[model samples]
Target: MTFQGSGPLDTSGVSAGGGGGGGRIAMGGGLGLVVTVVALLFGVNPGDIMGGSGSTGSQQVSADQSELQERIDSCTTIEQANSDDVCRLIATKNSLNDVWPTLMNGYTDPDMKIFSGSINTGCGAASSAMGPFYCPSDETAYFDPSFFQELTRMGGSDGPLAQEYVVAHEFGHHVENLTGVLAKGQRMGNDGSVRIELQADCLAGVWAQHADDGPDAMLAPLTDDQIASVIQTAKAIGDDTIQGSGSNPEGWTHGSARQRQRWFTTGYESGDPSRCDTFATDDL
Candidate 1:
């Protein structure tokens, strides 16, 4: 990856908070973007990965956790951007803000929240255990840098683009919000639920398509291998793959890994929203 984003592009108005009134820490890298569809339908246990809740408000943290806050606020230099995974997360955030709405056609912009140990959201106060998630109530995406570490624990790749794919995927959920598809799909849980998640994966692929659209595209033109990397990630987190193996098939919500990769590739190769219609197809 050729580092792009440096400092906070729009941190001025962005409010910050800690679990224990320790102020807001940047907690950049460990976070991964997840969506509610994965939780409510997939049986993946959003509580296990999304962390905190919508009701916990913005006050949650420990004294020691507060100390971690200091490190998060620093200027993310290019050196750190290359050397630190957290910094790459920041890049992904910057990149998504740059790419998302352009693809969305018409939608409101949403803020990205990066937390370390734990944080609060419209969903509730969540610990890092729940993984990265987007809370519709706050209209903000929440992430804990340590989530990638958890992904590694699950035997997933920790590559930079791979991680960015996660962020892009969550931003895809925000797209769902603007499109009103999220609320509608939620109503169609189980069968329709998996399609929603796959659509988001397709949207994430759309982001990757233009990740480097600017004068200085951080990552190289997404190679076939890179595309495959993200596809592999989609597969690894699929409902069927997780369920069939260890994640309980009955609880399947996000679709099988095969479905995930298929949808993502559909978007990446075509880069057309029309092609991302998981709803029209019976595959999902």
Candidate 2:
């Protein structure tokens, strides 16, 4: 993705922090090697950002300003040449802010936590092993670049668009949380879980459609093949695809590969939230 910001940011030696249990780490510079782990945490269902299952109940996470700032500063890519990760995060938020308001009317922005090995969220303490996620308890998103290595191992290529797609997917959950649709769907069980994830996938597609239009957008117009690659990545992460048929299909949280592709295409083609109505469909 080609982010068209006022100009690239100049965060050459910035750090990620301002929270407890904080420490400094060096930033990596290579685009090919840089990774991001996001937590898509929510109520009822754990959103994709942190790659967990279920939501937050009554959890309290005390804020430690300097430490939190330290964590944010520490969450950087390898080279830290132009602060691309920070720029990417800011640009994505700008994009989400652009579209989500149309769907929710007055949705407030959520805090984004960038960490390396682990982080403290309103939901609880989480390590990179848990993956990227969104925490509903604090209405924030968490990410670690380490998980991109796992995605590469699974045959997925890491690109700016791929990373943007992941970020947009997590933002999708934040949209659902504000609308209460996520909680409503969660009450519906596994079927609800599948629908929720599919909708998030659809939401990501919606964001992708408008990504190139914004001044601060980091994505270029996606090709059909590039789109397919993203869809394939989505399929690869499907509950069924990840766990396989050997696992009980009925207990699946994310939808099946077929279902995920179908929903993603549905949103990609239409570019409308209405087209992502997993609740009205019985296909899953």
Candidate 3:
């Protein structure tokens, strides 16, 4: 419902499956990635666990190709984009493409993949369990729309903006990849992981602030309710929230609920990507 019917959605860069028919489960480790879910959220290596560049992949998903095709086909109109998941993703991806370049020099769009079960990636093998993530090697963002259903079970909203927040968060990692901050995060401790994750959250807010702006705005004016939904999604995915109330900060990779909410609000209010420099701040 956030899309403004500005124009037809471009799904050319989007793939419903993995690159090169990706669907491979890695040996020894499950599906994993660094950005967003951060190596399956339990210290796994996405690059190491995922079978890398030259391994046999899988067509492991069980979704109906015809059904997926129908959804993609129907997403040409903005009205359809409002109601359909695939269409919404398409619209959101296009919106991000429109927004990021204005904020960063030499910004490039990341490949957005929607999949079920397992998929192969430049970073390695991945499953829906690793949640949404960005692979720097391929410069792509991977998403499992089913993860939204899981978000709902985790006490997060299933609103369109909430879903978009996750998309933006993954793309935030793409921005980090471009700026070389993601590499810094790779060598960080738990505290560093928290900083990177919070920075991504903030960058998501920066996207929201500008998504409906400019002459070619692809989205309608964002609302308070929608922003609140995004906040709920942020809180829902917080490591402290996921680890229960008294979770130790030492063991938490992503920041706490308060920190995530604060950082996102910082970005939204500032509407500046420069304000999202979590590594430079000690407040978190």
List lDDT for all candidates, in order. Answer: 0.62, 0.60, 0.76
lDDT, model 1:
0.62
Tens digit per residue, CA lDDT, model 2, 1-284: 34543443333323342222221122222211122121122212332223223322222222333444554455343233124555565456655766677656778877676665545567655555555667778887766655666766765556555666677777888888887878887788767776788888888888777666544444556777778777767766766556546655675667777877777777777878878777887775
Q: Write the per-residue lDDT of candidate 1 for residues 1-284, one digit (tens) a residue.
A: 54554434333213333462222222322322333322432222132234332332333344434544454455346445556655665666766776766666776667766666556566555555456667677777766677777666555667777788887777778887777777777777566667778888888777777776666665556667767667767766766554444455444557777778877877777776667777788766
Off by over 4 Å in 2: 5-86, 214-218
TM-score-superior candidate, 1 or 2: 1
- Candidate 3 residue lDDT tens string, 212-264: 88666888999999999989978877777886765777777788889989999
Q: How close is candidate 3 to the true structure, as a TM-score?
A: 0.86
RMSD of 3: 4.3
lDDT (C-alpha) at residue 137 in model 2: 83
Residue 8 displacement (Å), model 3: 0.4
TM-score of each: 0.78, 0.73, 0.86
Error of 3 at 153 (Å): 0.5
Between prediction 1 and prediction 3, the one with superior lDDT is 3
Tell me how far the alpha carbon of residue 201 in candidate 1 is from the true structure, in angstroms, after superposition: 0.5
